[model samples]
Target: MVRHWWLILIACWSFSLSADEVTDLYESRIEVATQSRDDRQDALREAFSSVLIKVSGQRDVLERPEVSRQLSQATNYLVQYSYVTERQQLYLRAQFDEQRIEELLRRANASYWSARRPNIIFWIAQETQRGARLIGRDADSEIVPAMRRQAHQRGLPISFPLLDLTDLSNLSASDVWGRFERPVQEASRRYPSDGLVMVRVQEGDNGQGYLAQWTLIVGNTRRSGQVDTEDLNGIGMAVVDSVTDRVAAEYAVSYSETEASEFTIRIINLQDLESVLLVESLLRRLASVEQATLARYHQGTAEFRLQLIGDMRRALQALELDNRMQRVEDPWSVTASPVLEYRWLR
Candidate 1:
């Protein structure tokens, strides 16, 4: 009887010790999970803090303390946690950063004036013939008008008036100097111009439908040496297209570098909120975003009043809902009420 009693007591003690060991193991797991969650949260907070500083500098307008605080909190939450899948994570991050994205868009408008204004000018061509009744009637006649129209469309300022063929016929050699040269010289004198375009129609074939050969002169220099055309209209269109392309090329090359910088900065700020939110959602239940009111006080601390979508219990439950058994941890907490005493360290 004494041996049996002693055996029963030993069995009871062994069972109790085993139970205690199991309990300790469970507690240890919970503690480890809790500490892991805390560590993740800290890492997320630090990343968000760094990004927020970059955003602040990029923003053209100063952000209100409350707004900055809310953004930081949301970003921190997004960084710390993630959903079960990459797709779900993406969705949540988008939802979280929607407001900040809007703010960045507003800031991007500040770069509108950074684009260089184009310098445009109008160009006119003058042609003179010794025996022709009209001043502009040579084979090059059709081309001059086409070039003028092209310049106008390209936003170039043009001042060439269409010369009446009769005016050319009426002018003698002496009047030629007075009529074309004096007017052009006066124009150059009064207005600043890049150059003048002049064309001389040396010959024409009426049977070939105004077929002509001509020399193109730009400011006192000859450009085509000589060009022959079966149709004056075709020549005019080609010249206009060529000139416009040349001008546009010059402007584009000169401004490309400056424009690229301005465009990059503008696009980044405009998209910052969306980008951050996307990154957050990709990270998911490990992190959750809440909309919150934020304000900065005189002391430099940022106060936040967060509003979560679900109740506290629901949010807390999310932290433990993963089925993968990957990691069990309570990653985050939100105050159920609108108490504003908690402040974020910048």
Candidate 2:
């Protein structure tokens, strides 16, 4: 099983995977024991559940009454599926209908996380019988493959450091083992990522199991978790799940509105036509927004009026998740004004 994941990781690296911009959010692959009709049906249901969890960024989404009813008929939501073989293991790769999935989330009043997700860079140090070593992009270790498998399962984008001469010169195994946020964040600047994760794993008491300590840093907010399991794969899965919960809570949009509301925002620091187009595209692509139109452009600043599915607050929260813009606290604007202010970052 671990070897299968290692091969997948190598293939992903060859494609120069970027975690920030995620595609195929509505697809999932589940390992099946056999290719029989009964097994195929069961795998399809599990794959549908995985898609729901991945799309909503919530592992417990299947527990909702509406979602559970839909899951009972998971085949209705599946767009296509085919059997795939890897490492002599049979699997089902399934694609679900995106629009239907979004409607199901709205019916359940659950949060929908768009494909635009944060890219988290990880620095991991481990202690084993041999000694301490850091896992890097080029590491041929079991831990890296396990972590990558978990990240893909959760629909989270994660990157490991190159650990080349430059990285080693700036960071050490002890620095990550200590969970130092400053040095880790400083060294991670070379990689364009939205979050920083530092982890340390070692043998548990009496060498009976594995224990992992992880810290997640996104901007000013920070979170940490500890996991202990009898095997390395369990530790990796738990650590990734813990971080995904935090990130999803911060970014996912909870659907509660029956109709769209009009909202306006002003974005400054636009450099050219390309910047303006990118800003409009981002606004229109937000899960909370129904439509976006440029209302005004003056003095290199642009104002967009958006038809949002949620309230202004929720829309603003969604905007904060994208790194292309930064909220600006304009002192001249009235406190009760409905229009928000931001500065384009690119």
Candidate 3:
């Protein structure tokens, strides 16, 4: 009879301890999840207007529709608390403002329009019997240089070669047709270019300057547009900009230009044998420097070398100035170990 009484007392003590632990857990949960009055009111407004809080994990705790509605309504006023299992911590935060979020979405849409690539090629026309004058013009006159410059400014990639119309100047109309056709047909080639721009310069209405007409042809399907101007520089720049904007819009890429300043360096220790290789290596590494080459290497008791390049400012910044060797004044000291001097390439 005494043993039975002892067993009953032990069981009652165990029950009381378990009940206390459960109550403590419930109180802690309530304390962590409760929110402020203002936050709850804001959350309620959002909840009433068709917005819903999406909680993925542990959603069974608030499964009832009424519970969810109440939670959403009080979310703004109620402190939002999240328990991160990995971190083992609770985060209390406020809800996002709908007005601010809507503005962000609108700006994102605008960015889509600005981030487009252009797909047009441009050419310039000059008077010539067989169009030899066109061929005589430099490669820089072709769409490649102007387009590359524009693309660089707009922060676009050069996806393909910029073809020059000068190459077609020597050909007859039939030759021109065949030249364009053979390569185009041989491999079933798709002209990586989206459109071709032809700029024709003729005597102006005033006869003082040239009258420029810009024509754009969109592939073989042939959708064309034209613009005319009296100032060649203005017309050229305007046509390129307009065509770039249109093509960029079509391709969906943003355009912007970064202007790179020129830097010059002179090397005073290059021999004829080492000149080519050394200059080539230097040029390859210093891409930001517009041009770099061995200008002259004189041999006596000591050797003297000269190198001219662009972008000295960046070079100094990159090299930290302290490590690079110094310039030589005495021609005699040059003969002993070969002196190198750096100068800006004009």
Q: TM per model?
A: 0.26, 0.84, 0.30
Instruction: Please tell me which predicted candidate would have the highest TM-score against the true structure.
Output: 2
Question: How many pairs in model 3 have backbone atoms within 3 A of each other, for residues 3 or more apart or on separate chains, i.e. clashes?
Answer: 47
Give each prediction's root-mean-square deviation over alpha carbons: 32.1, 9.2, 28.9
Q: What are the clashing pairs of model 2?
A: none
**lDDT values for all models:** 0.32, 0.83, 0.35
lDDT of 2 by residue, 72-158 (tens): 688899899998999998889999999999999999999898887888898999996677789888787777888888888888899
Query: In candidate 1, what are the lDDT values of residues 56-132, reduced to their tens digit?
Result: 22222225444355444544234123322243232111112323533442343311110111222222332345343
Residue ranges of candidate 3 with Cα displaced over 4 Å:
1-105, 108-119, 128-148, 155-166, 169-194, 218-223, 228-230, 253-346
Model 2 error, position 37 (Å): 2.2
Task: State in Å the error of residue 107, model 3.
Answer: 3.1
For 1-346, candidate 3 gives per-residue lDDT tens digits of 6436533543343211111011211111211223565544543444322211111101132433443444444433333333222254332323434333223323332211211122443444543355423211244444345445544433333333223453443333332222343432322223344345554545555565545444444433233344555555545544555554444333321112134444334454444433434333434333133344333344511222223233233343222211223444566764644333443121
* Clashes within 3 Å, all models in order: 24, 0, 47
| Candidate 2: segments with Cα more than 4 A from true spot | 1-19, 129-131, 256-263, 269-275, 307-339, 343-346
